[model samples]
Target: MLRTAARRMQVRGYADAPKGDEMALTFAAGNKVFYDKKVVKQIDVPSFSGSFGILPKHVPTLAVLRPGVVTVVENDGKQTKIFVSSGTITVNDDSSVQVLAEEAHPLESLDRSAAQEALSKAQSELNSAANEKAKAEALIAVEVAEEVVKAATA
Candidate 1:
């Protein structure tokens, strides 16, 4: 796959990017790395601050990501979108972007109807919570479900 991407980059005149001109991206759920260190030209993450795009050599920083879609644009211009259920995003000095998500799945794998149903259930639970703690948890669940539905439809 790397060879294929390199060939496409060469054909597009993008093969001249310097060593540090590309970012290696990793998406992990728990201790499992779903996508490991794939070379990408760009990545967009949904953060608590706001959604933002990262390019190679971006200033090193850490962000708390919200439940939303994470988009990766590869060297060959192929874009992959995943729905992330909250996480932390870290940009390393070596032009590496790592996302540690509580849960994540490719957009194509998402079931919009299921997500909508979950959203409805969670909302109902939130409205009928017996205590503050339960209410908060239900609220978070509803938010996550809503984000999943949005990502699936997007």
Candidate 2:
């Protein structure tokens, strides 16, 4: 079994690391890397079609993200949650997941009050939008701010 193999590797001094089907997750904003190649068990993404999970050896896919939370689960059962304004997720054949977000922040680091204030402001702007384009932009801002609040509160 896996435990026996691990024990043998340890006894042989062959680098006793937990072995599993791990995928590297990279979260980025434009050219800036928010999270480097961190090996994870799975990633929960909020795609336009709904929420989906990506695991190692998953079929290669590209998905448009909505304003919501992206959860990265490590092999040890620890979960990292991030709020993404909007983005695209690319699952490559090599079991690497790349996320390109318009804006993203760790849920644990966000101030709920600030997110609430931004949501209120965006809502007010949306109500007073002068044109269709302006209204669309304001709507997007409202959506992003709402997502931040939801993630922060969760």
Candidate 3:
């Protein structure tokens, strides 16, 4: 039997982008690199420091993202959202944002009760933290978990 090719290729370097007019965005579990699409004029996501928007023609930049909503609006006014467990988003020279997620999915399938329970647990852990760094990390976890739950129920 012949072996099948990888569903997606791992993006190596920025310069190695596919040679075409289309921009690329790659998620870890999917081979799809989101390129030109309608509806979305920009992408706004939560970074470690704060939220920022990535728009067409923006210069290349990179960011460490936190758990939150990935909202997209089509040029025609349609919108969709997904819960990104956690990941890094890289803005290429072409104005495309690549989201490398730890895990990702549509909000519809998330388990609300489970996410709520997890958020509760994380909150309790954060309250019991014995150090500053640990507390901060726990706080982030709580936020991520809460977002997940919200996305699920929203």
TM-score of each: 0.84, 0.82, 0.64
Model 2 global lDDT (CA atoms, 0 to 1): 0.87
**Cα lDDT, all candidates:** 0.88, 0.87, 0.69
For candidate 1, give the lDDT. Answer: 0.88
In terms of TM-score, the best-performing candidate is 1
Displacement of residue 102 (Cα, Å) in model 2 is 1.4
Best by lDDT: 1
Number of the candidate with higher lDDT, 1 or 2: 1
lDDT of 3 by residue, 116-153 (tens): 99999999999999999999989988988988888878
Q: Estimate the TM-score for candidate 3.
A: 0.64
Clashes within 3 Å, all models in order: 0, 0, 5
Off by over 4 Å in 1: 1-19
Model 2, residue 133: what's the lDDT?
Answer: 99
lDDT of 3 at 117: 95
